[model samples]
Target: MAQGVFAITEQRDGELRKVSFEAVSEGRRVADGLGADLTAVVLGSGIEGLAEELKKYGPDKILVADDAALADYTTDAYTNVLAELIQSSDPAVIITGASAQGKDLSGRLAARLDAGLAMDCVEIKLDNGNLTYTRPMFGGKIVAKVEIEGSPQIVAIRPNVMDIVENSKEPAIEKPAVQVGDLKTKIIEMKMETGDKPELTEADIIVSGGRGTGGDYAAVEELANELGAAVGASRSAVDEGWRPHSDQVGQTGKTVSPNLYVACGISGAIQHLAGMSTSKYIVAINKDEEAPIFSKADFGIAGDLFEVLPAIIAEVKKLK
Candidate 1:
């Protein structure tokens, strides 16, 4: 009988991603409800040490698929190992973070297993004792609930959407043998950008700039660094070459659901709102009180961000 909840933890450069912990916490809740054990699977090279970290958030067991071939993420390698684990465990439910890696791996695994998949789910709940997934639709204008009808339901949860609850369990470690087949693609080299601020998709807080910055990112970057939050940009800011495309948050860019989102001088275009509307708390700062951003913001300040940001920075610094 299929009996446990499984969470697939993603790792890059031998470090577990933030979303991995989020998935494990979510799985722990589901597993406790079902009165079953929760298992966490981490894929990487020389990352068996990460299994102990996952245990802090509570999982009955941790499966580490560590090998040289698994050092870099390859579609074929991760897919094969996960498919093998799923077939053997036959878990009641499988959850992963709806990240680039998560989306890629889960979709392929779903096809391989012929399982129902809920992608980019913002909420997962037990309604009437049935698994239900809630996700945004139509460019964040609407949200819909999804329910997978059978066991081993697969769900890819949106990053930073769920709270990480610590339930501390001494998870037993298992070193699984993953047969990595000959791959069409292999990692030759990997490059990483080490930034002072947090990753946008995984940040608990974010500070974003817009065209009003006049291409001056100094203040915006300072504020973000002060808060230890990620720096994001509006489409206009990116288009104007004030920020890189990677820092853009919007419909045409990346979606972010951080706990606290700060918008500086953004007018809140529909495309921009589509990406960050799911943010838990929004604070907008613009000289124009009539700006569209104010409509969705929890707090609004009418002032020049150039002047206002420094004052806010001063106050934030005083606290430090």
Candidate 2:
């Protein structure tokens, strides 16, 4: 019979992503519910030391595929090796983060394994030894509960939505040797995003600007600096050449669920809300009181962001 809850952990540049812990922790919960063991899979070159970190999240065992060819993330290499592992292990459920890498790998892996996949899941529940996933539909207007039939159900969970619980376990670590067949693609060069600010998906706090900034993000950046928050921009801001596409948070861009989201001069389009509506707390600043963002915000400031931002920055500075 198929058994074990398998959590696929993501790592980049030999460091585990924040979502890796969350996937393992959530897998632990499901394993407990289904009376199954939780196993975490980490693939990278020279990443044997990462087992110590995964053990803290309660995996009963960890399979480390330490391979030089698997160092960089490619679609073919990861899918081939992971498919072999899953076929041998026969896990009942497989979980991965909904980050860019995870999203890409899960679909390909599902097809290779002929498994059902639930993408961008926000909530996972165990129902009578089966798993049901809750995911947003139609651009966050509604949520749909999904269930996969058959063994080895695959799920990709959204980042920051799942809590990382520490359930220490003395997991048996195994270094597995697998053949990573010839790859279809090769990385010639990688252009990394350089910044001190936390990644938008993993950030605890974010301050975003919109078309209301009139193409000037000076005040928004200053406020973000004072609050120690990552700077984000709306789609309109990005289309206008005010900010790069990477900085945009919306349906067409990266989805973020920060602890605190401060919207400056944004009119809160539904597409924009689809990304960050799950933030723990929202603060919107716009001159228009009727702006759609205010309806979702915990606190709304009906004033010019230029004037309101400096005040917020000063107050934050005083607190610091």
Top candidate, metric lDDT: 2
Give each model's clash number: 0, 0
Scored against the true structure, residue 311 in model 1 reaches a CA lDDT of 95
Q: How far off is model 2, as Cα RMSD?
A: 1.1
Instruction: Provide the TM-score for each candidate, comma-separated.
Output: 0.95, 0.97
What does candidate 2 score on TM?
Answer: 0.97
Per-residue lDDT of candidate 1, residues 85-197 (tens digit)? 98999998999999999999889989988989999999988855578899887668778988987767999999988878998988889998889887788577766676556
- List CA RMSD, all candidates: 1.6, 1.1
- Mark the 10 consecutive residues where model 1 has the least summed lDDT: 188-197
Q: Which stretches of candidate 2 lie above 4 Å from their native place?
A: none
lDDT string for model 2 (170-196, tens) is 999998898899888989998987867
Give all candidates' CA lDDT scores. Answer: 0.90, 0.93
TM-score, candidate 1, is: 0.95
